[model samples]
Target: MLRIVLLFLALGWNPVAGAAEMGDDGLHKEDWFSITFRDVAEDIVAAKGEGKRLVIIFEQRGCIYCREMHEKLLADPEVRDFIKANFKVVQYNMFGDEEVTDLDGEMLTEKTAARKWGYVFTPTIVFLPEEAPQHVSVRDAAVATMPGAFGKWTFLNMFRWVHEKGYQKDEHFQTYHARVIQEMRAAGRLDAE
Candidate 1:
């Protein structure tokens, strides 16, 4: 037992080893996030061109839940890899003055856009479909909106369901999440506790 402990210590093994770095805006920064002009229509087009779905994540400085999400759930290798492979993520500051163009061709500041979209929480994640209809705002065309932080399984499953286009199916997200949890538990990937 002592030798095993010494080996782990020498190897510098850490359970939470891969947390992303925080940006000057006090948000977690990752290489997977796109640095775009914040134009909804153009972003959607670009994301689709890359064969990836568009995902806008809104966060503010000093949000504990956002910190938890970035540090714990998103830091997980499986979740991070899946997101990087399948989604074009965009980070938006909830209270920022940066200009953003809405899908309907309206220009607004990030804060105004957040209000227009009715997002009341930090760490709100908006998932867009492959194609959006003309003359509609992003909020009107979003397929799914995650309002706040969630557990590792829920967060990963949400991304998976969206990537698989499960919204078109009859199965609800709650049901799907339960099924996924059961499968993970059975596979011993998740602790039963």
Candidate 2:
């Protein structure tokens, strides 16, 4: 299948610069934290059982942002540490052969699942419970969706925003964004400020 070929191609790729391998803590280190996905459903189920959040990073073969997340953002030591401690990460080829049970109770191809969830772009990360309601289906977002690439500081702020359940209070990213910026200033990323 096309996806099979693409997966092989991705695995074969070398960044040329040979970025450091990220560890379980989401830190760029000398170990491999990247997992080759086998069974998504089972892994998510276990991850939830263990009280780990599920961060499903959906990406395509040719997406540069996806590569950056893999090579830069995710490869960063801080991010890697946070991810390892807080989440069970999974990667899927947007058009791969993986069959995911979407927000709705329908089983769909990874490609169709992405479309059904209405993510029309590459590198959408979905945060959700392990099992969604039967009626939710593949066509709807089963959980929270973050689209596009955000730099390190912004993404970390976003993580804190979610961690504090800020969205449930205001449902406004800008509100949380400002609050996080203030908090960051208090912590004295003065140079960043």
Among these predictions, the greatest TM-score belongs to: 1
Give per-residue CA lDDT, model 1, range 56-168, as digits (tens): 99999999999988877777788889998999999999999989999889999999999999998989999998985679998999998999988888888999999989889
**Per-residue alpha-carbon lDDT of candidate 2 for residues 70-132, written as tens digits (9 for 90 to 100):** 677766778677767767767666777666765444667777777766777767776655554
Q: What is the TM-score of each candidate against the true structure?
A: 0.88, 0.71
Error of 1 at 160 (Å): 0.6
**Which 10-residue span in candidate 2 carries the lowest summed lDDT?**
25-34
- For all candidates in order, the CA lDDT equals 0.89, 0.62
Segments of candidate 2 deviating more than 4 angstroms: 1-44, 138-141, 190-193
Report the number of clashing residue pairs per model.
Answer: 0, 12
TM-score of 1: 0.88
Q: Which residue pairs in candidate 1 collide?
A: none
Residue 129 alpha-carbon offset, candidate 1, angstroms: 1.0
Model 2 lDDT at residue 57: 73
